[model samples]
Every structure is written in C-alpha cells, then in structure tokens.
Target: MTTELETQIAKYQKWRENLRVTLEAYQAWLEGHGHADIQRSLRIYDLVESLKSDRVILAFLGEFSRGKTELINAIFFSGYKQRLLPSDIGRTTMCPTEIFHDPSDEPYVRLLPIETRKSEESIGSLKDKPVEWVTIKLEVDSQEEMAKAMASLAEVKVVDVDEADKLNLLNDSEFVTTTVIKQSSGKVEIPCWRHALINFPHPLLKNGIVILDTPGLNALGTEPELTLSMIPSAHAVMFLLGLDSGVTKSDLEIWQQYIRDSVSRRIAVLNKVDLAWDELKDDAEINASVERQLDETATTLELSREHVIALSAQKALVARIRGDTALLAKSGIETFERMIADEIIPAKQQILRAAVAREIGGMLESSMASVRSQFEATTNELKSMSTLGDKNRDLAKKLLAKFEEDKARYGRHMESFNT
Candidate 1:
C-alpha cells in the first residue's frame, strides 16, 4: 500500500508529467507552422503554473449557540448546506478545531491528538466518548464538510464520531495544523475538539487569515490555556447574537471585556430575527424592545446602531444564492453582505494593495468577486481592469497578502528546513 506521503508525491509527479506533455505538444506544433509570440506563450504558461501556488487561509467565529458555523457554511460553501462544521445544542467542540483544504477522492479530517495515537481503528465512531485525542479521518469535502460542521445543514456522515460515541481523547489536544504546497494542496491536521473554537483559513478567507469562530466569552475558559493565546491575536472580533434574545446579560458582559476592550473591527449580528418578524406589527412593543437592545448593544461595543444588523442568517444565505438583493434587504441580510463586500473587502484590499505587481493577485482584487464584475466593466486605469483577446482579468489582489500576514502570527507552524 502506498503511504499518504508517497501518494502525494505521485500526484505532484503526475502534474509535472502533464506539464511536460503539453509543452512538448505545443512546441512540436510550433516547429513547422508559424506561431505567434512563442515567448508570450511561455510567459502565459509560467503565469498559469505560478497562479496555482497562490492560496489564502481564513477562520470563522461566533459564540457556541449563535449559529456561527451555520453562517460559515452558507457563505463559504457557495450556499451548499452539505459542507459545514459540526454544531448543536450540547457543546460539540471539546478542543480548538481547525479545517484546511484537501482535494482528493475521499475527504477526511486528519484528527491529530496531542497525547496518544488512538487505538480505535475506525475514526467514524469516536465522538462523545471520553478520550484524549485521535487523528480520525472524516470522508468529507468542502460542501459535505460544511453540512457536517453546522446545524443549519445536515447530512448522514457515512461514519460520524458524534453519533458513534465510541472513542475519546484523554488529555492534551492540538487540533489544527496545515501546510500549503505549490499546487495549493496540503495536509490539514485536525483533532477531537470540544468547547474550543475553529480558527484557520480557507480559499475564501483572504490570505491565510482565518476569521475566528469563538466560543462566546462565557465558554472560552474551558480550554483556559489557549483562549488568551488565540483571542488576543485576532484581527477583528464579531459578536453573533440572536434577535429574539437580543443582548442578554451574559452577552453584555462578554462584549464589555473580550470583544469591546480590544481596538480592531467589532460587529454584532442580530440573528434569528426572522422569528420576531411576524410578531412585530411594524411598531409593536417587541419591536421597540429589539430597537432598544440594538442601541444598547451598539453603545456597549462603541459602534453605531446601524452596525447591529437584524437579519436572518438563513434568509441572507438564500438571497445570496438567488442573487435577490431585494430579498436580502427584506430578510435583513443586506447589512451583513455589505460588511463583506464594502467594508471587509475594501479594507483588506487597502492592505494587500502592494501585491498587484503579481498578475494573479491583481486579477483577484480587481474583478474576483461576483458583485465586483459590474463595476469592473466600467473600465478605469485606477480600477485595474484588463481586456485581452480571450481573457479579461481585473481584480484587487492585495487582500490575500494582508490577511495571510495577519493570520500567520496566530499559531502558524514553521518548518526548520533551513536548519
């Protein structure tokens, strides 16, 4: 049986062989017939080769019950509910969890245990049971991963540790580790986690900067050792709350310290407000109470009341899929979307502005996202739009670099190859 490492090396070799074949075929064709700009073709090949190496990581964050995982799946997985992080009512995450990219036939999470190698041969049946840690593999992909990761989406994991309740990690747990290669594929190490959080980057997240999915302040202390380590280094803090509950006493306490005390971006999302829509008769008492809560929450966080958006994460996800901006507004998700498109993108682009010297980065920034397509068509040198015979690439390419730089400081692994 081929080792995983050997398989990976083989894959790399296959890619190289494919490259050689294509080059030989092209060169042969150009030998007899007149071909235009052979140097240009080589440069195009080089760019195509180089572009594959570019990758960014990101993380998602929120409180334990705030439906944070659900939102992550809906947005990042292209509205596909099958792929998500596992979430439920009874504290599912027992350790700090991480997810990294792995493109293969059978998807799996390499559950890495800090203490011991698990004796249980099967990874599909190790959840709920008390064990130290085990590097179990989950047969999942991005979309399927999202479904398993969040509550909003659900699918039958051919094998699920949670339902199996057959294994457990005993003590020390190091849940996440990942390495990117030239093809932008790498090994992602994951472990059995509970109470902790998920703070790693993916393709969607700028750079390798992971937007943290935190365990609301109340629950952070469970893994007391790593909480302070992770929280203090994050780029921004977002407090996800339920609209029906508004800002409860516990939520206020958490905001006052962990989220509000810091000096980066802070946002509060009023989720599940769809529940209140029918009850609130335009200007009813319940509606007024919600408004009051929004104001107070904003004041507590030193943000404008407008920053506290009352939207259904679910509805906003739907609107995004259908490209129904009007429904998004009606569903109240437009505010959240604006945060991603206008604020977050603009800010990150400002930071990554320098990487535009690279073609891939430039195209990513100038015309990468769906929303920006319309704007790029209007053509302006300042905006960096390009139109060639067959390719039209224009985008702001700076956000990835900035995001990666920011995220690296927070538990990025470095190999001592130089030594």
Candidate 2:
C-alpha cells in the first residue's frame, strides 16, 4: 500500500518532472528559433538542473533518547523489517546524521573523524573532501551487512579528558559529568565521528526527501555548523520529546536556541505515548492522559496543539514488521505521517512553485516580448510589399530601401537582445 507521505512525494516528483520537461522544451524552442544565447541557455540549464536535484530536508531535533532516531526508523525504514539506525537506550546517535539517496554514488556510510573538529573547516566544507572521511560501503543486498555498517553511527571511543575537551565533547562542569561517561582508566568516552552521511536508496529518499537526525543538546551546543547552518536550512524540523519525560530543560534549551525560529515549520513530536497506556484504564481515559500531555507540551513549547503529535515509534515499527494493523493504528504513526503528507509536503511544493515562478516567469515574459516584436515587424513588411505591387518604379525602389533599412535595424535589435 502507498503511504500518505509516499503518495505526496510521488506527486511532488511528477510535478518536478513535468516542470523539467517544460523547461527543456523551452530551451529546445529557443535553440530552434535562434534565440538560444549562451547566457540564456545556461540560465535555463541551471534552472532545470536545480529542479532535477531538488530535495525537501526535514531535520529531527531533540535531546538524547527522545526517540528521534526511532521515529525516523518507523516512518521511513520499517520496510527493512528491522531498526536501520542505532536507537538504543542512552545516546545512540552522537553526531549529526544525514540520510538521503544519491544515485551518483553507491550505497555507503561516510563518517568524518571527531578529531577533525580541531580544524577550522565546517562539516559542509569537509564533505567536499572525500579523503577527510572514513567511507564504509553498505551491502544493500544483505540486511546484516547494512545493519552492521549502520551500527557505526553509534561507535564511540575512549579518550583522555583533555582530548575530549579539545574535541568539544566535554563540558567544564556538571553537564559533562551528567552527559559523558568516564572509564576506570580516567578516560572519557566520545563519539567516533563528527558527522555521518548515509547515501542509501530508499524510495522516499530517492524521490528527493532528505532526513537529518540530530544529536542532543551537548552536540548541538558544541557543533556551531549544526545550529548555525544545517538546522536553519531544513524545510521543516520535527522537535521530538519523550512523553514519559515531557519537556526536559535540555529539550527546551534545544528548542529555544536551535529549533525555534530556525525553520519555517516545526512539529513537536511527543514520542513513546505507549508509556501512558494503562491496561487498567479504558480507551477514553488513555486518550485523556495523552491529550493532557500534548496540551502541556504545546503550551510549554509555545506551539499550537495541532502541531504537537503523540506517537509510539517503537510500537509502530514492531506493528509494521509484524503486519499488525490494529497495533499500527493504535501507535498513532499514521496520524503523524498524514500530517507530514498533508502539511509539510504541500508547503514545500508551494515554496518551490513561488521560486520557479520568480525565476522562469521573467524569462518567459522576455521571450513573449521578442516574439511579439518579430510578429509586428513581419506584419509591417507584408503590408509594405502589398503596397509596392501597385506603386511606381521610383516608389518601389524607395520602399525596397526602407525594407532593407528596417531589416537591418531588426537584425541589430535581435543581435543586441541575444547578447
């Protein structure tokens, strides 16, 4: 069955494909009609390419263990019949991870070493230098191999406190003690990678949907690139919170500092609602408890109640893998997916439409003006030739001269326009 998100993405992809075809046709027309100047052709080419490679980036933001990664797995990767990313208890995803499909490259996991943080280069810049990253090829045919490669997302290494501090993985105070683990060897544990990029060929990802799964507050606070560039660039941000914990201080801090005002669309995901399900209570009572938490979360986050969603990502994944329709519906994942399909995807389409109109609209207008000018010139020349049939030889010669002059002027105008 086609999911709502998949259906919307299919529509979006079709729309984009149609637009690309139209632009390509326009470019061919310009070439056929001698209007295809280098500058004009290049502009059209760039626009077409942009449409071809366009992506909708949705970033998930929250503190550690909020089910951010789990929600991602349930929503997008449940088809594998297993958890695709590491979402175990206690800080699994330690660095920012981007999951998208790029057919130009084979399936692979690329990790940038944490030690690279010592350099002034940003993650965006480092991505251009392949040598700077550790590449792990994914065996897409084997689920076990793929899972093993993906487990590297949670890979951590023991380092001295001084090294951890230098890498910005440790704090100077109580936050450090709470967040980082100290070994008996007097060494601190830190993430093995500074950033991770997964180029997998998932269906939705292939249709130009990019998912960014961000780490908790400690990583967000330390990585300026994430808070400064990545989060702000996302089309929408899903701010996940554990229903059991409600809104923690760190979650609120992440919202205020990194999420709020960073993106145009924000969804406060109250994950793990199954925790509130009591067998002793009826359906109404269970719903009432979930609603109360949703209200509280919305009020605390200063978001509308509609924007706050409650779901059990773990249960959803289990139900999906087991093909249990009742459990799937009860998990509330469908509701959340519907919101993405109905709201976020359409919003992205509108933005794309406005941008394309702003860009291609002007070129179209200019082409129309040029066509109109040529039509007028042709009409006048035909009128002159008709009049010449009844005129004397002297008048005919003068009219011919006028025709020559007009043709020359038109040629000059077209040359200037093309340039």
Candidate 3:
C-alpha cells in the first residue's frame, strides 16, 4: 500500500545509507594503507557526512496568507490526517523557520530570542546556548499535541517599543502592534521572535529532507541568512501564490528581489485553486479556467507552463485525510509530488554522485602520486645496491691500471736522470 512518494522516499533512504557505508569503508581502507592525505581525506570525509546528512531542501517562499503553510502541510504532513502546522486564516509565521530532523537531537521546538539579534552571531553558533533559546519538548505520538506546540511559532511577546527596537524586531511598527495597558501606563507592544528551528522525527526529514517554510517579505528581507545561505543552498524553491491574485506587486517584488537569482530549481505554484473551482459549471469550464490561469501565471513569471503548477493545498490535505483518491487527484498535489519524487530527488542523487566522484577522484590522484614517488625512490635504491659489487671491482681494475702507468713513468724519469 505504499504510494509512489513513499516508495521514492524509501529508495532514496536506501541509496544514502548504502553510499554512506561504502564511503566509510573506502575511507577506512585508505587510512589503513596510509595512502590518504589529511586534506584530501578530510574532504572525502566531509562529503561522506554531507551525503549522509544533506536533505533535499524544499523551500516554500511567499507573502502572508498566500497558503504557504497550508501548502507545506498538504505536501508533507498530510499523513497525520490533520493539520500539523498552524495554517488558520489570521495566524501567520512571523519569522523565518526551518523544519528539519537531526537524529542526534531530541524532538523539540527551539525559538531564538529576538534579543540575540543585537549581537553578531549566526544561528548555527547560537544553537549550543540552550539558555538563550526557548525549548519545548514535542510528543511525537500525538499529532494534536505537536500541532499545538508548533502553533507557538506565531506567538508574540509583549515588550516596550524601545526594547522591540533594540531587538531589531520592530521595523516601523509593521510587524508589531501598539497597545495601551491602562490609564497609568502608556503604549505597550508585542514583538515576534527572530527565527524558529523545529526538529522532528518525520519520515521525509529523517531521510535527510529539510523544509524551509518562509512567510512575509519583511521577515525574509530582514533575515540575511535566508537569502545568502538557506535559499541558495536549497535544492528546490517553490514560490506559492494564490490564483485569485495571480502575480501581485508584492509577489513580483519578492521574486525579483530575492528568488529570481537563486540557483535552486524554481517552480511557480498557483495555490488555492479550489476558489477558482467553485464557480465553474462543468469539467470543460474548469479545465479552461485552470489552463488560462496557468498560462497567465507562466507569462507573468516569464517561466514555462511546466514550471508553473496550480493546486489547492487545503483540498489536498482534506482529500489525504479522508482517503479520497479522486479528490486527491483533482487537488493536483499528486502531480507535483510526483515531479518532486521522480525528477528532483533523482537529480539530487546524481549531483551527489558527481560530488562523490570528484572528491574520491582527487583523493585517489593524490594517493597515486605519493605511491609512485615512493616506488620510484625505492626502485633506484634497490638498483644501486644490486650493482655495488660490480662497481667496486671495476673501480679496483681502473685504479690498478692507473698505478702501473704512474710507476712506468717514475722509472723512466729516474733512468733519464742517472744517464
């Protein structure tokens, strides 16, 4: 009863595991034979670890209320048979969040305080300081509990405007709201945290897949890491937009400003197709409308129709939960999921293969040069030792002949002097 998605996931998992083991053995062999240079060995080791740890990072980028989270839940978490991420109407993911799995760590939600942004520290460096982040242990057995814990990503803490500004969370009061506590107190405010990192035990994530669910342009613009590190390194980036809005000014700005230059494979998603579905009378009308939007969106983004996909993430989630195959097919998630599994994942595997080949090839070349140098030096020494007796005899004969010639010349000089 495994779906194509599940089958592909399993296949990738097997491939990675096999690759890791094979590389580990090769590294051991090279180490034992003393053929591995430190630098080359380290590079090979790092590639092996990367192959083991690297996730097929699928980053979902869009503005608020564009169904970015809903799309994520539909594509990744529908197996829970309910909404895993907080995708309600008003709630928004205020900061950049990365959902991934590290088998070494426990399942928890780690929120980096906005105050830490005042200092010069990357998120990676700050991960070890448990006191600076708020950690919440997750009950992986229950989907509802995990859902409640994940809802905290949208939670805001009330702080003075000055404090919010100092934390760099306040940007012209757009992300925060002004409030009055009482007659005595003046204005109060709530500031969203800077960023969120959630570690979980999801199957896809455990198989080395990371999902970057980014919302709001303001947050994306503020987080330089998103543009410089996360987005650029991701294997795939999906820009989600609603069909009703087509390509809005904000969407265009986000695309042109940040996403357009990304090296990752790009896809323009026209989500919330269910809204467009309701007005159509028949199948023909539905197909015509869907095709029209697809064409229009592709034109707006200056991409081909193949790169533009239209789907209803909400309906897809519902269909998945209810086990409605027909509805799931109509949701268009299967087509997109298939594209990811068959095309993107396989392509990533090929990329990894090339990287492995390059790293191992370098290591082998270095080792071969060292081995050849040692063999040539040893060969010259052995040849010199093997000819040592012959060389000594030849030197004696030459020295004897030179001595007889010098004696004959000395006798002639003495006789001439006597005469």
Q: Residue 138 lDDT in model 1?
A: 44
RMSD of each: 19.9, 4.5, 13.6
For residues 1-419, write the lDDT of model 3, one tens digit per residue: 35577679779889988888877766775676565678767877798878777778889997678888998898778888898887877437766789999888899988887777799998777877888898889898888889888888777656665665565554555432221111214334443566788998877787777898886675676667778888888898899888888899878988888788885588888999888776537878887888899999899888878989999999999998999999999999888888888888998989988888877776656655655565565555545544556667776566556655555554443333222
Alpha-carbon runs more than 4 Å astray in model 3? 31-34, 37-40, 172-191, 365-419
lDDT of 3 at 272: 90
Q: Among these predicted structures, which one has the highest lDDT?
A: 2
For candidate 3, report its TM-score.
0.81
The whole-model C-alpha lDDT of candidate 1 against the native structure comes to: 0.46
Shift in Å, residue 115, candidate 3: 2.1
lDDT of 2 by residue, 1-419 (tens): 56888988989999999989888888877887777899888888888989988999999999989999999999888888999899999888988899999999999999999999888998989999999999999998888998999999998888888887777667677663433567767698888888999999988999999999987877787788888898999999999999999999888988998888788799999999999889999989999989999999999999999999999999999999899999999999999999988998889899888988888788878887987688587658757675767557677777777777777766655554444
Better of 2 and 3 by lDDT: 2
Clashing pairs in 2: none
Question: Backbone collision count in every prediction?
Answer: 61, 0, 1
* Candidate 2 wrongly placed segments (more than 4 Å): 176-179, 380-419
